[model samples]
Target: MKFQQPLRNWGGSLVILCLLLYLTLGANSLEPLLGPLAPENAPAIYARNSFIDLVGWHLLLVLIAISAAAVIAILAALFVSRPVGADFLPLARSLANLGQTLPPVAVLALAVPAVGFGSWPTLIALFLYGLLPIFENTLAGLGSVPTTVKDAARGLGMSPLQRFWQVELPLALPLIITGIRLSVIISIGTATIGSTVAAKGLGEVIIAGILTDNLAFVLHGGLIVALMAMLLDGLFVKLERRFATV
Candidate 1:
């Protein structure tokens, strides 16, 4: 029963992982299936870089970017939600808003001259693009805590920090997780554009397909990206529900 439950819980993850493995490891083997999808004179496979390597690098860049954005956003939200830090709320919101206001491609274009090409520019763009949703959701989660609950925590002689950790944060975690989910999905989609700057990612395949008119390459890259987003989103949804029940 335990094994069965676990299998059921991870069914989607397993399926996607299997598909990703088949697509990446057996891409060349797919010539029969994908041959018809390739435009005349264009290759059926994206062979410039191994699809697996591109997927790995893409995930790595996103992980780094989203981790940074989440930390900064959550901390900023925490500070601004505090009474002593209330005055800085507008500034914090404005900072987060500014990041989301600009398109990721623009950020990448502007960042390239400053940092040059490759993963760093992509990281910068993803970090900036991912900031707003997490920041806003954190703020909303903290704000949603009931005044009565705060009073109750204080009535128990808990310190502000203790109350936040034990009470407020627990209540707010679900929404914060939701924000992270949104940020993750956005970062995944935006990360595709990073390949334009010589950053390693699934975008390499998509961009190559566009340039060469290879529909197979485009579909292959887009499929992986979409699957990754769905998997992460499902995991986050589970976390959100788990925390909400607590």
Candidate 2:
């Protein structure tokens, strides 16, 4: 469903309100991090710049993880969506559960020993942690497709590939978006852990804040990350609704 203009505007307004809150409350409290912005410095601008730079720095790796997960999810969904593919359901479920059961930090630590620090280990860990929600959702969404729809699509002379693309996928999109939204939000949270390995992100500011007892700084970094995740999730939800309506 195309979100009506009023609803879309309302979403935008809510985001603006959040930013304002972050600026007014979160920023003021953040004086601990920056030791009060200098006369020449603008705290809000500085925070915004830091958040943007942090995202820019890791954008490529995050994209890699997201792309990999999407590909795997698509394949898994297609496979499990078919009647003959029932045998793999147990394995898919196990994999999804196992991915989450393994602690990402522990995985990161183990990976560090082999891969050695920086972004690689962190990326791997985050990627693994992210697989479950997306993979499971993909499988579940596809499985939930009405059998009648599939039969009709097949009867209409649509090839397996064509039916999958046209029928199964469109019906499954909302669930897929929900999975992706969860993965993206989880990735945002996990990315902060990357700072421990000296990979740059908002986590660096947070870690610094913790080490220095700069409440303002830590809160500033954290608040920014939270806001970013919420914004992305909100956008994805809109997309989800639109696709579901189609």
Candidate 3:
């Protein structure tokens, strides 16, 4: 009976993956299915760039942005959680929220002037957007470790560094990963906007739809992002459950 669920999930995963492949690689095949939705006399497919390249660039941008954000956020959270750095927590928090406080468009506007168009502005915007959740989650995770656990580590003659590595970090990993999961998902959605400025991602397909009033193109791109997001969310959820069990 337990094995039945895994088999079902495996089947579902294959279906979603096949649909994703059709949308990204064989979009032309969808023309008949989507024909009525497209504007009259317009091509239903997004032909500016390969959808494969768009997906690749989209992933690259998100990965780089979130990776940079995670490093900074996790480090700041670690520092401020310690006794010596506790007083600086507010500062760290404010910095983490600085991205969320300003809309991505505003960041892009400000960044474009300094960094110019293309991926740089998009990367900066995503980096800023990813900071708050990671920092807050890591901080919360560290704080959730019981006082007795630390004492117990001390009781075992472990140093502060050893206590953190051997005891606290493992307990806190699930939440830290939760922060990463959130960041990764948010970055994926946000990276789409980078296309407006020629950053070249799935957003290009959506923008094309909007410009030509082709709902099919928009659906094409949206479905691809949505499916990929679902798949990734499922993967992270499994990770969260696995670690929670541990």
Task: Sort the candidates on lDDT, descending order.
Answer: 1, 3, 2
| Model 1, residue pairs in steric clash | none
| Candidate 3 Cα outliers beyond 4 Å, as residue runs | 1-14, 94-101
**Model 1 over residues 1-246: C-alpha lDDT tens digits?**
124333224687778778878888888898888889998887888888887788888889889999999999898899898888989998888777776777767877888898998888889888877888999999999999999999999999999889989999899999999999988988888789888998889988999888888899989888888877777776777788788888
Lowest lDDT 10-residue stretch of candidate 1: 1-10
Cα error, candidate 2, residue 43 (Å): 11
For model 3, residues 1-39, the per-residue Cα lDDT tens digits are 235344226566778778888888897788898888898
Q: What C-alpha lDDT do the candidate models reach, one value each?
A: 0.85, 0.72, 0.83
Distance from true location, Cα of 5 in model 2, Å: 16
Query: How big is the RMSD of model 1?
Result: 4.0
Ranking by TM-score: 1, 3, 2
